[model samples]
Target: MSAIALTRRRGRRHSIRRPRTGFLLVLPAALVAVGLFVVPLVLAARMSVSDWPLLGEPSFTGLENYRAIAGNDLVGQALGFTAKYAAVILVVLLAVALGLAMLVRRPRRGVGLLRTAFFLPAAVGLTSAALLFYELYFAGLSPVDDALTGLGLIDRPIDWLGQPGTAFLSVVIMMTWRFAGFYMLILLAGLQSIPDDVYEAARLDGANRWQTLRHVTLPLLRPSLALCTILIITGALLAFEQFYVLTNGGPDNSTVTLVIVIVREAFSFLDLGSAAAISMVVLGGLIVLNVVQLLALRRER
Candidate 1:
């Protein structure tokens, strides 16, 4: 062959081999996803459409479980509570995280230490953090109550998790402490990605701190903000560990989240079919919410 034709043949062979190599590299991850996620999702869907007991052969039940969800008082209550909790957490978490990110985004003395301290709670496992807060919120052992009493704030120890409002507030506080630092890190990264030239131009244009933040910083930080919002909303909607450990959905099932209700249905009541139906509903809701959020937050080309 001529030299040019030989080169073309070699290029064609490399292009063919490149796709095979890429597929080979991706094959393991695809298999793992199919086994771990897809398989379980399929099983759950099947269980949702059948009368699946905890320890019996599942019989097809059509949409009875889904239909039952409409009349279930607990499900309605859980949905309302979850929506409220998600809204509160989304606001609190984003505000706290943005503040922390702005606080530590500038390079200065002790900034590294501050960042570490802020992020420390995020490194702790969620269950472990919830357990720690559980102890801290307990009546007699709680130093918070002791301090308040010592300061003469109250004649009695306040039941931090004993009532619906207090329980909700306590869970929100714990969640903020646990997740604020992580979201701060995300925002900080976003802040650092903003070019210094933009700030300098804003300053030259006589923009004050608030003006710069509102006009320049916020517009640039949209991606990070969107990510944090999505994560906060999703996590709050699916919250279980904090409420379970701190309140046990307690004093009157006031803090029962959707996930908690699903667990109760599955293990506590041994009604796997109903639990699966709830799970599917939650899954659908999450998918829809995420899609809406993405559409709302999509950056214009």
Candidate 2:
């Protein structure tokens, strides 16, 4: 064979082997996904359509569990509360994260330390953070209440988790603190991706800080904002550990979230079929919401 023909023959042989090699490398992850996610999903779907109790054989029920959800008052209350929490957390988290990202985007003295300090709370386990806050909010143990009392701001210590409004506000504050730094890091990356020339051009056009931010900065940060919004919405909607540890859906069950309701059905009420059905509903809602958000926020092609 000619030298060029020999080279072409070898290239074709390697190209044929590449796909096999790639599939071999990906096999482990594919198997893991099938085992962990696909299997459990199939089982949940089966349970959702059956009368599955914690201790009894599962019998097919044909959508009875789903029908039961419509008349369940607790499910309605939990859905409303979960929606309200997601909205509030989405707004607050984005605002706080954007502010932090802007503050740390431009480096100066002690900027790294400031970034670490802001992100430290994110490293703490959610349950641990909730426990810490629970103690801090307790009347006699709370330094906040003590300080307010010492300053004569109130006649008595405020019950942070003992009222519906205060309990909701407290959870919101904890969630924001826990996640603001993580989202800040995301936004900071987006901010840094924006070319400095864009800002300089805006400045040359006599744009002030506010005008530059509104027109130049925000438009460029849409991808990061969308990511943060999606994450915040998902986390808030599926919230469990913090509320479970802190309030236990207390203060007249005002803070009960959808996930909590599902757990209550499965464990507290020993109705696995109902819990599976609720989980399927939550899963469907999440898929729909995420799709809508992605469509809305996707950049024009």
Candidate 3:
């Protein structure tokens, strides 16, 4: 009787394990993510607390780096600039993309060609896009000076990157040109997913197109909009290549992003400790921002 019971139990266990092949298939991916991503991030956290140089054993410094950065004026200014940049870019990207998506949401003449043209720039890498913008704006391809001069809009040709305010605006424009289409794609997908029944109901209720959008469409698109916002905000905060390639943080450190500052500290000055400290702070901020966004999304849901 005991042997028979054991055999039955063994058969049950085999049956249970047999169809878990899909889970087994994912185990390698899980292992690779843990080994490569999780481990390195954990190592970075550990390094954040110590005085680690590129050439020597890291010393146990216990919050010294954090403390130093806390009082540093440059760090504070960089943080302020990063926040400002993120805010400006977020607003512009979301607003423009939403408008574009709404305008081109439906099938229209030449829409396929228009979308292809718009999305092409996003396919270009950040550095390449920035370089292209730099050449365009500086080398007369941007049409800023030409447009102004052609319409008699200005008395003289203006150098967009020669000053702080205009330099910042130039970067924003470059970002907008390259990224608005990407956000448009996300929002456009959300728009396409919305059922026509909802619109018909709105129409039956005497709602105009604007009314339909406000009452039915925008609500359904909340998730995709949130995703775009988070991505744009995060990417803008980490902005480096654009400023580096185009402005080189020039015109009096106007476009000097925090990441650019970190690179200078680490690679240029060979100050690994401060650089690591900056990265640690950046990581902490990103984690906090992501947590806040997640909670807000959960609340909305």
Candidate 4:
């Protein structure tokens, strides 16, 4: 009809064609998310509402599992222990990782080697690392025990994972060793990204190392710290392998984490509905925590 109308129609056609290529490229990933994540999530939600035994017909239960969750003492203990463990591990991991990051952040001859050494444990599978530590803890007449005894650290061989306190501590040490390096890499990247001019300005302002770190470096590193905090908290809350392998929820089930509680409900006890309900609770809690963290950070920004 008109020249402008024709031009507008052609532009709309080109815009539609342009989006097709990107949409096609993203289709595979979308399908994967729906199949792997969305479908299982929906199924789990359904199972949570039904009495789904391991080998029985599913029947509608309608909030029975959720009701059980309220009166479950084991679940309460698991959540309490998990919270304490998460808090302790979060503090330890942040301190250790930050120390490692600062150590290797500066240019030095052996810096690469140090970074590699710190991060090498993270490359190993978590289960593998847990098993390895389990062996070390139980290895009888070994050098560790011998050295400790020889140095008068103990009167005799000590079972590191025998007591509840020591067993929890052992897991914490193993987790810190395994994950500190990974977080170090993240913090180191953040450290490197900080503009040199900022540090120069700090120095020019006569701010000493500690003062500069307290004022400038920490403020700049908040985002990375937040990420590391979230990861460490989530991992600690979901801790399963180390405690499962090492403690087996032993010492009167003192080291049972929230994830272990879920696994026990589902597989160990063959109560899928209860497990699904617990999982939903965990999922909701995590979502709330992450949302709060993001909102707090956004407000600060």
| CA lDDT, every model vs. true structure | 0.92, 0.92, 0.86, 0.92
- Of models 2 and 3, which has the larger TM-score? 2
* Cα lDDT, model 3, residue 222: 94
Compose the digit string of candidate 3's lDDT tens values, residues 241-268.
Answer: 9988888887887678899888887788
Winning model by TM-score: 2
Supply candidate 1's per-residue lDDT for 75: 97
Worst 10 residues of 3 by lDDT: 11-20
| Residue pairs with backbone overlap in model 1 | none
**lDDT by residue (tens digit), candidate 1, 192-251:** 999999999999999999999999999999888888888888888898888889898987
Q: Is candidate 1 or candidate 3 better by TM-score?
A: 1
Look at candidate 1 and tell me the lDDT of residue 174: 90
Model 2 misplaced stretches (Cα beyond 4 Å): 1-22, 139-141, 150-152, 299-301
Q: Tens digit of lDDT per residue, candidate 4, span 1-301? A: 9999878878885454677789999999999999999999999999999999998999999999999999999999999999999999999999999999999999989888998999999999989999989988888437878899899998888778989998998899899999999999999999999999999999999999999999999989989999999888888878899899989988899999899999999999999999999999999999998899889989988
- Deviation of model 3 at 53, angstroms: 2.8
On a 0 to 100 scale, what is the lDDT of residue 95 in model 3?
Answer: 89
lDDT of 3 at 213: 77
Candidate 3 backbone collisions, by pair? none
> Judged by lDDT against the true structure, how good is candidate 1?
0.92
- Write down the TM-score of every candidate: 0.90, 0.91, 0.85, 0.89
lDDT of 3: 0.86
